[model samples]
Target chain A: MVTETSLSPIATFHSARRGRYEVAHQGVLALGEGTIVVEPGHNFEQGLQGLKGFDRLWLVYLFHLNQTEDAPPVMVKPPRFEHKVGVFATRSPHRPNPIGITPARLLHVAGRMLTVAQADLLDQTPIVDIKPYLPFCDAFPEAAVGWGGLAPTPYRLLWSEGARERVAEIASAHDLRLDHYAEVQLQLDPTDTSRKRIRATEQGFALDFREWSLHYEVRGEAQEVWIEQVTERPEFPGPSSLK
Target chain B: MVTETSLSPIATFHSARRGRYEVAHQGVLALGEGTIVVEPGHNFEQGLQGLKGFDRLWLVYLFHLNQTEDAPPVMVKPPRFEHKVGVFATRSPHRPNPIGITPARLLHVAGRMLTVAQADLLDQTPIVDIKPYLPFCDAFPEAAVGWGGLAPTPYRLLWSEGARERVAEIASAHDLRLDHYAEVQLQLDPTDTSRKRIRATEQGFALDFREWSLHYEVRGEAQEVWIEQVTERPEFPGPSSLK
Candidate 1:
């Protein structure tokens, strides 16, 4: 066997809060409840300035909450897969190393902080690394979808009695705009092909677009819809939200 | 805080020679070895049948040999770095997962057994998974090389007394050519930029290749290199391997 060598970390990351991370690579990722700020213009600009020109960025973060002693699975039943596929074939949170990567829109960057748009990650997720999205290298214009074929048809959200009110309340409290096409687009099925129907208690309403059962809990008064859970079936067990 | 989900093993890897591996989705990865079969084929073909066309397929195996129960370092000093770079910057085996990917040309496959070209792995390393390399996706026509910068310069090996004779012996025994460019290219850095220097020893020759010190022992009158110890160097106590 060829003898191997070790390595060391160049930077460190500290979680300040949900959606916010502080990376000790000369600057910090000040993620506020809604807006993110990076202090010290120099460091912030150095890390995020070039990102502004890109339409999207790849966020490589640690699944800090998924740490466990159990061995990682080679196959996973994704929330949408409903336990039908192997873990390696699906993008499930459960993996050997919970290294989460998401392609998110680059809204803006101020100093060391970057304000991202359309991010599905929870607040305060530790951001390990970031790279600009190159359309040529990152985007496969004519790529074939594996098992989860073409994108599913768009669906409308039907909120129940108290659902709309709750959405509005949550939006007001968070000081975020709820009624936007971007937000609606986020609800569309980026994966899956066939359409179905599903319902859940946590989420006020369920709509099946393709193979996924999308659960939405709308704070009615707030005019906002929060995705409570996404599963293959309405009867699937809800994920435990520790916080 | 989101509720923590129960950690569970998602998959289990089994091998006759290497220890079994229980992998969970999003779990840490350990290195081991496995065999790969290469079928003759062209890049234009699709599916398993095309895979049989190539005499050798590249194996991107993991370097699970040096894994330990320690937090990974953020930086590492690579042997090519002359022991000065950080771990994250180098491809050192000492990392959080100690995952090493190498491309080994496939030789032949009989049933499930594969005879591959020279590989740097031990006898039985667990093979994680395999995928047919698509030249369109994997190859970069104009990729830039940092630090070491592209392929190394070529060099001719000048074996000491009995070294060439030993090469002949191994060739005849293995029914292969052992004294050609393949062996030399595999043994020495083509660029000859490696700081390692081989010196004649009582047994054969000794060379310090950063993480491991190597010694060559004669194989039936033919000089063959046998691995000695894979230990750390005090003179250049570089960073830990994992990060």
Candidate 2:
């Protein structure tokens, strides 16, 4: 009947993926690389010895960006599936314990720093533990996955010339990754507005992202999604304005 | 620069493997089954919805039995490998965070309880998180493991009828799993005394287990190990006796 346990970070991950929206759903789908810097003065260097030989490593980290103070929702809608599933059945950060485990390809290890790729982690994410991936134990290619294995038809993402330029502009201006977010949210369930911040408009559909929105439309069999434009949402009066 | 995070257990695992010695190195190699009971009043039942559809699950748990108050050794010698490796390179419980993750075969999920098999967990192990195993993301059978992949010749374990009866007697009397402990410690390195509790005797080799010891011999090419007898150690004046 242990109530609680306290854990400290042994290292910090540095990645270009600065926010949750920028991270890929899976590490193998991540496009770029990241670095892990182990804290000093704890003899962690010795702990890292002989780790460079492994091709992959498992990182145990905290979902530090979880902002909700209340209990997490038991049911969550995963982007890949149509129905809402239990939080345990989905890889959602909002959990009883906001812990995440991801495997990254080991590129090189120098002193207390490790360079890895295909890691779907955010910038400055705290890493609590690291273990070399043992293929015989960790891998199970033939394992069954019920509803998850039967993936729905994925939408082929297509960005118009205007939309691509606008996305890049948003990335530079606000440090927001709308492109990656759109891919993660709209690729599988393009028309599902129940759980997504999407609504039908005169043109087609518009997905909201705080102060901005991305307008898109679904084509034949909803297999192709064309992001036509990105625009700033109209500002409205708030409590601050009233005050 | 986050300092620490507090985490509470969402569930507890019940298993026949009561101690670290009885548990296998990998879940797939474990002998028996276990049950995970999610704590009530947390809406965990809803959290477990749709988890049964998964064939396997990843359990994130704490190594509650790690007794050392001091910092863990940076390097450790794994059983399969001869040389010492980095703590991060092996699945040792003596870690900075003491967190462990293992994938187990899903048997059944009823209400807040989950029945799983081949779980290498101690009795009453606290489970912080559980996630359905997605083969597309979790599996990498072709991944490389450096020194770990080069497994040494394993010793075939053989027990005499007398020894078998003696082991059963000890199990009933002391409730200690000496048999499983011997298999884990001796099967890979039968005579490696550097890291294991093995000592050369007049007749053969003896492995210590508290007040008792198991005597065995390494046969031809060290490919076979024969457990001849299990006997109590000679009584000595311990610190408690002096006190």
lDDT of 1 at A160: 47
Docking quality class, candidate 2: medium
- Per-prediction interface RMSD? 11.7, 1.4
Q: Each model's DockQ?
A: 0.03, 0.67
lDDT of 1 at A203: 28
Q: Which ten residues in a row have the lowest lDDT in candidate 1 chain A?
A: A20-29
Query: Can you give the lDDT of residue A129 in candidate 1?
Result: 45
Per-residue lDDT of candidate 1, residues A158-238 (tens digit):
544454554466447754322222133333442222423334454266544333344666554544556554445444444
lDDT tens digits, residue span B100-167, model 2: 99999999999999999878898989999999888887788888887775434557789999999998
Write model 1 residue lDDT over B1-243, tens digit each, in one string: 222222111112222223111110111111223454322221111122223434323233344556564655544454334434333233445544444333343444354345444344444453333333222222333433234323332232345455556545654664333333223322333223243344555765454333333344434323334433222345644434212
lDDT of 2 by residue, A1-243 (tens): 677888989999998777676777777767678999999999898888888678899999998887344688989987657789899988898898989999899999999999999888889999999998887778888888976654345577899999999999988987778888887677667777764478888999998887778999999575899999998778633323211
